[model samples]
Target: MRSLLFGVIAITILGLTSCQESAKKTPEFYKDTVTFDLLSDMKSLLDENADKITIDDVNNLNGAIRYYSPIKDSLIGKTIGELIEGQKQRTLSTNINLTQATAFSTLFTQSLKFNISEFQKIEQENGQPLNVPTYQFQNISGKSIVKLSGVVDYYNGEQLIKRFTIEIDKEIPADKTLNQPYPYNHDAKNQRDVFVRDNFDKLRKVWIPTMIEFADGKIYKRNPDKKGENQLDKDAK
Candidate 1:
């Protein structure tokens, strides 16, 4: 009887030890993963919710232009023949190319929040319509990201739309310069860089709606005033 009792106790101790070892434990370093749930009110633009919001309440850049649909579109009596060669071509090149009226956009975001910080105002002007002062913060997750509330323009050449983009105010880890995409030809490389830079700039045109709120009080929305290409320009020197 005494031997049996000792054997049972030993088995119980071993089982408990095995149970502890079997449970998976997260690495200590994982404690530093940022966990702030703070995010922009994205549904404002998605939900079929009626258009109670004004032109400024939300960005209108998405689906602004259907890309690469038309080839050549000309006005009446202004066919390519008279516009190009002196001869009056017989049949119309129905290929009249007209710019589409919509485009698409996607924004990657990083959420950020903190225990305390100073109040800041929102403003938009010139080509870059964004200004949010950096505020100090302490987070429980130990990972800190900058809070930047901004908007970008969605455009394809002549077509333009406004997309509201919110970010943690840090360069994306995987972001690469547009000019770095694989290529060998010299002239092609130059043209490719131009295309990439234009695309990048088109990603920066943001429109400030009538009113928005932040750490401060009510704020006014503003869009960049510009002519020329009628688009934003972004390229690193």
Candidate 2:
């Protein structure tokens, strides 16, 4: 079965190391899996909205693409500017003019997507120090905070199917000098591409496995056979 990886974006987008002593992952935790029952749960949503706006729904894409100097490369006229066709230093902004467009109001009644655990531990990059995003979601919600910078896997019975991973560090929440209250960053989205369908497709393929290292120091491979296999088979047939 294909997953939409609802929370998979915006977090786990970066890679790093060593902010704390590695904690041993619980054997059962490795057992507690991350699975999406979207076909069953989200069917209504897809049915209602999937067709209303297909990828071709994109009408026009407008934005500025700019190139800037690195933190160290300020002067030298290397400061950078608007991008040219194939400039050594460039930022390209191609406007996509589609025939149709989709509206945001459609999701009001259709929110079908997998959840991440909130009381659940958010996976920090292997070793980056913790910083507050200044935003807050009730850690108690058990809503999964999808790891943006990771790989996601799809399983069917005992079979491991197709997979891919992408980093969302660019979207990962950063530590803030100030903190906001709950539901602050939840559902926050910024449009990048003309059709978000392409972005969603990329996210669905990533395997955002939970971070539960064993006492022996090996990583946990999220096995879907135990629970999600039934759903996989149901969807497949």
Candidate 3:
């Protein structure tokens, strides 16, 4: 099927590392497989509010957008208004807009576009010592309206942290054959643009973590605050 997602955004997957000695002691919570059936939820939501609501009906539609920081000479942060303003002001070139816009509400009701789970482990960082394994879902389809991307966070030797989805892109071609789940016309001028910017941090804070199961038979349940920030040693537990 031609994916509802118009384009594929490639995220660099880090190479695999040998299962460390600490990894051998992986927690019992992560021993079993867990899955978050977002497709089912999306379907339920669509069915419940069929012909009734748009993306505006729901609340807390958290998301972010990548933009180049002229001062730093790099793409440093995600902000919708800043990005738009930068483009409008001619300070940033329009050729740089990589992905479209995504709203969290519309993302919750779509099916994944393609197979994307070959690698899931993220290498340990400085402050966050434990290697984190993540499950991701991208380029969803359904209703032919909105597409979304997803990530599920899991600790190396503990439980999960967050399972959330974000919008894929702002602009979607008008499909008269397809049902428009959201009231807005995605093809309209600046209609799909972000209304409020600078909410990326707020989105992270307000996002409620959920449980998820991977096809590989590993289950993950959210364990918020189990380990303090910058706590690294897995054996100390």
Worst 10 residues of 1 by lDDT: 98-107
* Steric clashes per prediction: 18, 22, 14
Which of candidates 2 and 3 is the stronger one according to TM-score?
3
Regions more than 4 Å wrong, model 2: 1-147, 172-207, 210-237
For model 1, residues 1-237, the per-residue Cα lDDT tens digits are: 999999999999999998766543322321222112211322432254333323322232121111111423222233212222222121122112111101101011112222112212333353332223232222222232222334334456645532434333332122221111111122323544334344543432333222122222222222323211112122211
- Residue 183, model 3: lDDT of 19
Compared with the true structure, model 2 gives a TM-score of 0.16
- Error of model 2, residue 88, in angstroms: 61
Compared with the true structure, what per-residue lDDT tens digits does model 2 show for residues 125-200?
6543221222221212122222322333433434444343433322112221112311111111323211222233
- Report RMSD (Å) for each prediction in the order shown: 28.3, 31.2, 32.1
Q: Name the 10 consecutive residues with the lowest summed lDDT in model 3.
A: 191-200
Worst 10 residues of 2 by lDDT: 96-105
RMSD of 2: 31.2
Kindly state the number of residue pairs that clash in model 1.
18
